[model samples]
Target: MKFQVRCFNIILLVLLLILIYFFFYHLRYIDDDGEPIGTVYITETRGRLDKSILTDYVKDKEDEYFSAANISVPILVWWTPFTYDTGSYTRCNNNNQARCFISNIRKYRDNKQFSAFLFYGTSFRLYDLPLPRHDHEQWSLIHEESPKNNYAFSFESIMNMFNHTATFKRHSDLPLTTQWLASIDDLLDQTYLIDVKEKTQLQTTENLAPIIYIQSDCSTPSDRDLYVKELMKYIQVDSYGGCLHNKDLPENLRNPVETMEHDEILKLVSKYKFTLAFENAICTDYITEKFWRPLKVGTVPIVYGSDQFQDFLPDNHSAISMLDFTTPELLARFIHELNVNDTMYDSYRHFKLYQIISNDTLLARTMSERKWGIHNDRVRGNFIHQFECLVCERIHKTRQDPTIKYQAKFDDYGCPPPTTFDKNGEKLERSGNWYRSYEFTRCQLEVFHELLDQKNYSFTEKDINNAATKRFAPSFRRNEFLR
Candidate 1:
């Protein structure tokens, strides 16, 4: 009887502990640091989080908003942007997207929850610089432009909506002015390139050595092709594997078609002499992961980006470039000679091994920094905080709005009705109704909230729920090739 009693007590204790653990773990609440913040949550569905590029984006965004333990409002991100109702941040045509944003705000003014909104994109300069900001008004608007070059600027048309003021300046402007504002540093995935395991699995002597590679997509222009062709001519395609241009191929040149599932490309790099690392456009800081993939697989990279490469890369790396060799024939001859001479060939491999070893410390440090403490401060000033505070303020105000109808049938469902045309009182169905409507998951709505909250924009859950349903449906004109 005593033993039974003890067992019952033990089981009760275990269950109690579990209950306590979950209760605390599931609770989401705000801290009191007063930083304006938001979070963008990428969906883990489709096993998409495994890819480095997408993972880096999500990590960078989270770190940007939630850093410094600064308790502010939280905003969640959804992966598929098309499904969510952007609320006031709708994407109209490329030139008219900003106008669409303005129009959305006007349409939803009666609903106090959606007074502010935030939208991020790469092409800020093209949207016509110098956005509007109001002074010391709660009904004011705020906009943030994140340029592709790892930097952003904030303008507050509504100054009262911000806890702290954000200043705007140009890239080429004075150092003092630029320094006064916060610097938007990139949350780099420092472990982007690591690991150097050599593979011994060899099937054939011809396929033994990996070939140098360059893949040009279908969208590349003729001028881009000319540049690639010129580089390929210099790299000596005959000696290396082959230069790949999916669309246009010369008769003498054999097409280099790679299998999608085959790590053959990576394997080619590992066993090959060197991989060509040419940029699609020079002077652009968008460092494609192509440069690091070869290095991660224990292969040498011949790089050709801007001087910014030096800004981001380590010094004294032995990677060759278009600037290094005098001519294509000379480069080809050198590569051929290295292929025949085992000593010279092995020396190149040793250089690659040394490169990997040299960057090991940096790689580990970057990974740890990303994992902890890096996102400890919020950089968007107090805009999000103020907006969230204002939202709470509005919610209190609306509770007393005697004229406000809380229970109104909103167009929440995303499904659109068929369009009809009338001629002489006869209704006719509009042509081209085959296109489907867009769908949104719960995760997307959370992200849209954060993005708008960053702009000090507020909208109701109903408004957000409605906006999440618009899909990216474009109709081609009869003259267009697609049509």
Candidate 2:
């Protein structure tokens, strides 16, 4: 009787373990109408924050079991530009940065390690090659069968609609209307503004100092040592702000640039009158945090971007002056004139305070919306078009070439390609076994317009005017926002 009871207990334990395993592995979801929901096996964590948990799931022996929903919300993954230039896999390996920056898209596109990049951020240089192909039209696999009983889960809506070059429609759809003006105001409220009187009370009047700020770091891909050397000619040796370079500095330089924590940097900005704001590259409207930090800190931002700085400023807002003169003698002379002329100096300050004080509410709203994984409003609808092009190319090529196989490589990214012309002036064909590098640039725009026009998503002159009035105006050339 005792032996029979022990055997019964062991069998029950094994059954309970099996039930728990199935429960955690399954993904359950509802349709847009909110009726019946069903379950499918989800191999990876779609929305969880734990990096290790997702890593373990992906490392499983059977990669086939891990399936994901076809919710093609224009997926965005951001990383510091340094990752691509050098193998900084140490920092990348810590937080699944490798997957986010590089591998995730490769996995999604069903290629071992190749992705179709439509729009990348400021730093990474682009390669001029046709997109690569994978064996599977993995995009269609998700749509072929619904994971749940009642609802049809299709990536068509997400991939087909969002992700365009002209607009970041994947992010938000708040019409660039007068009503959206409040978003920028809300952003300023959350800005870290140190009370002036309180800061003064902490420091001695004797120890009071000037500030010099640096924007980009020394290790960045676009590091400019010569630009910093030229800037030193204008500002006093004692004043500088922002993140300072770690490279060697001259001995005579009395005060080095500040290297504060991000929060501490904001706190220090409010206490100083002058903040050094330089662009990493010339003639690019790629404005960084340097544009706003000074305004929030109540300091005069010594601007160092492009000649078009005025385009980004609000109408009649002062508190900014450009680095106009080229020669050090001319620059030094102008700096002296601005400092002594009290009335002229005061005029620039008029628009400076309101940029931060008045627009507090709007600034807060903008920041909150940018916080990741909040609302899926389908801001733009071009990402899906690009994915569809890739999907079709993959399927079409497989039917043509039977022996094609996927190979992981880094050759396509960092270096520029050799000259396109062959000895006879015709373009050279790729040497790969499969035509993975098949060109498809001609028909993409036509397909995009067809889908958008079908959905009645037309942008009129009124839409352009409304967008310009609220947010910055769209510049076809710069691709950066200018007000």
Error of 1 at 301 (Å): 1.1
Q: In model 1, where is the ten-residue run with the lowest total lDDT?
A: 172-181
lDDT of 2 by residue, 1-483 (tens): 999999999899999999887754332132223322222212211232334433453464245321232322222211211112111011111222222112222233332222233222222111211122223322221111101110111112223322222112112222111111223442244355444444344335624333345443432212233444554555552333224443332343323233332455566566654565654433223344565566555555666553445544433444454446444346545655754554564455554434543334332443344422111223322222222333334433444574653321221111111112122222223211111111111122233344345653444435433433433222222432211
RMSD of each: 18.5, 18.9
> How much lDDT does candidate 2 score?
0.34
Error of 2 at 100 (Å): 18
User: Candidate 1 residues 293-345, lDDT tens each?
Assistant: 55555555666543334333332454555446554455556666755565655
lDDT of 1: 0.34
For candidate 2, give the lDDT of residue 25: 33
* Candidate 2: residue 141 Cα off by (Å): 23
